[model samples]
Target: MHTPEHILIINVTRIGDTLAATPAINALHEHWPQARISVVGSPHHIEILQNLPGVVRVGALTKNSALFRGWLGAKHFDLAVVYNYDQALVRYALRVARHVVAFRQKSPAINRRLYRCVDPDAYPTVHITEHALKLPVALGIRGANGRILYRCTPDEVDRAKDRLVGRNFDGKRPLIGLQIDSFPTKSYRDWPVESFLALCRRMLARWPQAGFLIYGGPAEMPRTQWLKQQLGDSACLFAGLLSLRETAAQMALTDLYIGVDTGPTHLMSSFDIPIIGLYHPRHPARSLGPKDHPLNFSLDHPHDAAPSSEPQSMSDITVDRVFCQVEKALATRGIS
Candidate 1:
């Protein structure tokens, strides 16, 4: 196969899904060092792709925007790899690129048009990162690393530090970031608020100067506000105040991150900070936890051993189990 000058990678999904595709993107860059890699992702979460190594351009493309793309434009791309099964995106890639690689779509005709149509089910992998890597692997491109990539500008980093200083978190030891809930649709993944309160109480007891950075969207305000009220002066609420990019910048400053299996958790994994991610039974740590992270202490629900048709509660994971991992993470950093 000839080396391509320009490559377009499309993943119009949520933050976690978008981040899952980073390793694949990295593989493509490593294989063809001179390729100008352009990414199209979800509008709300596309900022996460900004400043990633080897990716020259990042943009948002929704199903609506994909409708009009490639109609008047020349076929400028040498190759395009799409992670989405959306026919519109694949068709757009087909129109604009000489060769296109994507998962087999529902339409046999569309699959025939792809330069390489990968069957997702054929490669049954335990982890989503590996599953996403299969797309690049189909082109004989091996992954450079398992870790997800993210970069915050120096200005953004400084602003985050300034915000922390304004909140008097300058000298606070172990500035822990908390992602209290998943999205509304996946509320079952959320650990009980009571559990978080218990964990915070334990953390405060251990490190009196420990501060909490509460992160969430507006939809999770009630839970985040309650946590803030419980933690009092020790917690700073950034739930509804900061933009996604701003949140990522602030996340880079944290000493530790303890969250559910959500987008921010995936984003936090990109950093070198210690993280304790709680997973539900359905989405076990093996499938969604941080990969190749030295400080990852992810816990899975007890019900993971016994899958049932009934909905499982995340509360099955006791506060004690999580605090034990917390102690281990802090001890590794010589904070204890």
Candidate 2:
């Protein structure tokens, strides 16, 4: 086994998958403490993982970005770990690294050359965090903790604090964070907006002083606006207003989170806060759930429905089933 002096991790997936790769990155750092590590991923998510331990730098990857043809290519990394199947990224790794690791690819067999290989498709039942750590484990790097991870710089956390301080929330009252809408592409994962409004109403009835932070992106402004209007003065909108890191930093201050199975929830999973990830049949909690977290108070499709089968409606989740869990998570944290 070669001890790498410089390592490259190509994880060009979105926020959730990028956060899922943290355990593998952590393991790589533990085993090769002296190796300088660089991670290249989606432009939106790279900033979230930039300040992590052992990460020398974070770069955004794209084909026309003059990427591998530039300074990144100049660095001859001793090892490269490819986490996504994007052929462009794989080709870039092959050009700049001496040893490459990745999942097995189909015919025309570029993945056959990998020094270490694990088929992610082979482990359908395993958590994504476990699946990611498999790349490092296949290289004989053992005992890697497959927990989900994230970062919030001190300044970022203070920014969150400032937002809260302005609200003048009672310190004892719970501060909740909500991500009402999922990414447009995964809109099927979203629960009914009425269900969310009902859940908030129930929480408010219990703790009138309780505040909420509603989160989403520009694409979700309409929905966010509607929710802000419903929650009124007690709720604040975070969608399209903060950077990805800043959103996470602000989210870190929440006492609890209730959101669809989306990227920002990955940020919630990082903090020691309570998470209630609402999942529909199209996306079961088993496959893409919150990484087996201790605070994972997730609810799958209410009925025992087949995940592979397309559902006629994604609104099957009931407000009662959700409110009960929110109450339960709060009670455990002594917020009741």
Off by over 4 Å in 2: 66-75, 107-109, 122-124, 169-172, 304-312
C-alpha lDDT score of every prediction, in listed order: 0.90, 0.82
lDDT of 2 by residue, 1-336 (tens): 568999999898888888989989999999999999998888866888878889998998865552445345464899999987776777778778888888876635687767776777554467778888889988899987777778778998887888778766536268899998888887878887888888899889989888889998999999889988998988888789888888988788878899998888877888878899987665677767787577888888866455445554557778888888898888877888
Best by lDDT: 1
Listed in order, each prediction's TM-score against the native is 0.97, 0.93
lDDT of 1 by residue, 73-136 (tens): 6898999999978999999999999999999899999999889999885322458888888888
> Could you tell me how far off, in angstroms, the CA of residue 148 lies in candidate 1 after the best superposition?
1.1
TM-score of 2: 0.93
Alpha carbon lDDT of residue 205, candidate 1?
A: 96
